[model samples]
Target: MQPGLKLSQKVFFLVAVPLTVQLTFVAMLGHLLDQAEKEREREGRARQIIHHVNQIHRIIIGYIAGVAGEGLIGGGSKLEQSYSLRAGFDRELPPLQALLADNPKEFAHLLRLQKKAEASAEKLKQVKRMFKHGGDLALAGELPTMKLILRDLISELEAILSEERLIERTSPKIQATQRQRVRELLLTGVILNIIISIVLVFYFNKSFTNRLAIMMDNSIRLGLGQRLNPPLSGNDELSHLDSRFRDMTGALDAAARKERAVVENAADVIFSLDDSANFTKVSPAALKMWGYDPAFLVGKHCLAIVPKVDAKKTMEALNKVKSDDANNTFESRVVRKHGEIIDIVWSVHWSEPDNLFFCVAHDITERKIAEQVIKEAEARVRQILESLPIGLMMVTLDGKIVLANKTFEEVFGFNLADIEGETIDSILVDNRS
Candidate 1:
């Protein structure tokens, strides 16, 4: 295995290993089958040779019997039968020779046997001509000599049969040896294939799972704010995945830092509450707004800092932001640690996964106080204006009335509410219509 091997290549190697072994096994099995076929063919050829040898041997023995059986049969029938036996011997000879032709030694022996048969033929012709012309008594001198020649030929053929039968006898043992070889080859092939597969699987599994474990450990370290492991030394998919994970972690860390800086430098109070509505985090502005240590506010219930009069409204605001991405904007009075109450306009957002409510509180106490003073001044002006106004009304640049005195209202039969947003053009058009 190369150090820089890719994942797909490793996977291919894992599959290819066993496949290669199986292919090799199949190739070897094919060779064995070929050998078995050849052996079977050789055995069949031997059996054919044995059959032809037996037929020839039987005809040669009959030849000897017919020649010596003159007293036991009529002369004419005996001569006819002798000729027929001679023809049978001639017919069987060529086929036996052909069968033995594959073996040089056997073919040479058969050639010699054919030559000896030819020599006996001349001797038989001479005796047959004597017996035919002069009858049974004429063959008395030649019978013993002719029988000797035929007997010698029979002796040689029997020797050949003995050798052939010996060969035939060993066929079963040879077949058994072939069978054993086949069984051994099949068993060896199976065992080798299994071993190859198991070894490769274990090796690939070890390497792959080890790398996966390292990647998993890196993820845990990242989550716990610990340093990550060094990048893996490969171009495999797992290594690529680990690199991407590191990149994502770097991006997330940058984003978190930016958010932290924003929260720290912000002038308004920023805080978070846990699922139990307990204060879990408070920004640095807590000291300026709440007049308390941010650490001191941790684990404190939100209602502790909320005035009783505004507690219900604050609870309602919290409920409004219950689901993820939901937000609520409202104003509530918060009690400072110094026991003073102040108005705060809150913008709250919910994050269900974190089970926290993120809130920004802007103190609106000064704005509310200024609003009260403006309303009081407007009331005093209205009193003075009502005392001396004679159909006097205040209008905006668009000729829409903004304010009207009682005198103006009585004369026009219109209050400021009726004409406050109406353009001069629309009002005149309405009056004409």
Candidate 2:
């Protein structure tokens, strides 16, 4: 899971879980509210039925005591009391019927109560009729039966009241149970949320920190110039970075190898000198050119190998190369390890990054010897030309007098230096010739 999920996905999951839990909790709270509303409605209906039953009982008592006059015993006449009682009965009957309809087992008990109420209502009507006929004794005689009917009705009402009271008494326990369920659900949600949070934290921390630690160790190894293992693999950003780092290191290694090959196999004596003109590095060819190991030359000043007679000139050239930031070529005599003075032609350039001068020196001893031999032969030829008795001159194809011997110059009464580059026609007797 950790490998499959990205950092952002992990964070989103963490956030979404809590929101889902909250939504579920809200749903549960809504259900609890609905249950509470139903409990309140049940309690209200039971109280209303009890109130109606109580009103009916009061009217019955008033009728039996012959105090059913307006504001006499219960605040209305007997006929008015009957109407009020009927209204009360009418209000109470539907709920009772509904209760019996819902619970048919209670129908047997309610059937007896309903018969007694009907009998009481009939007796009430009779007593009212007797009063209208002025039969006071007959009305009085029917009072006991009416009283018995009222008693039976009251008893049935008391039974219903007892059932309502029992229901009322049990309501708190039911509410308590519901409340306990809500608390349990809440506690379960909290515990589950906490457990999920803990698991996410542990997984994320372990996974992220472990991978990051591996990357950190790899970076440290790279810094120390140590070999690295295969890069971490995944589609995550860190994995991509690690792969890119691997590519960069591979490129750098190839470049270093190529540079090392060039430095090692170069024919010229390649070396670098610091700003103070001291050698920092010397290639292997120095051993062949200077008869000194390359390692022995490092840290030595450039003038250390130059002959005393050429040291001043070499220093001047070095200064020029450094100040002008340009390539310089100069030939100078250097003393080898075996105490021999050899000629070498050097090419030097200043490097800004290392604050050093990169130099390539080529051994020019044989070339210098050949040049000296050519110079001696030329001097001998000049001596022979000067020793000639007759006048002689050399002219180029372009009609210029290129050379004239001392005797020729003396004979012609003209100096060779003055007529060397002059057109042969210029010195001729006839200018056109």
C-alpha lDDT score of every prediction, in listed order: 0.79, 0.77
**Candidate 1 on 1-433: residue-level lDDT in tens?**
5547888899888878778878987898788778777767777777877777677666666665555455335455465475555587678777787777777777776777667877876776676667666666776767788778877777666666666776677766777787788899899988887888778767776668877888899989988999988887677788788889989999989998999899988989999999778999999999998898899999999999999988998897788778536788999998998899999999998897798988899999999999999999999999988877598777688687677788987887877777776765654444565
lDDT of 2: 0.77
Q: What does the lDDT read for residue 216 in candidate 1?
A: 90
On TM-score, the leading prediction is 1
Which regions in candidate 2 have their CA more than 4 angstroms from the true location?
2-83, 86-123, 130-198, 205-209, 234-244, 273-280, 291-335, 341-357, 431-433
lDDT of 2 by residue, 206-230 (tens): 6677778888888788788898866
How far residue 109's Cα lies from its native spot in candidate 1, in Å, is: 3.7
User: What TM-score does structure 2 among the candidates reach?
Assistant: 0.69
Number of clashing residue pairs, candidate 1: 0
Q: TM-score for every candidate vs. truth?
A: 0.76, 0.69
Query: Per-residue error at 228 for model 2, in Å?
Result: 0.4
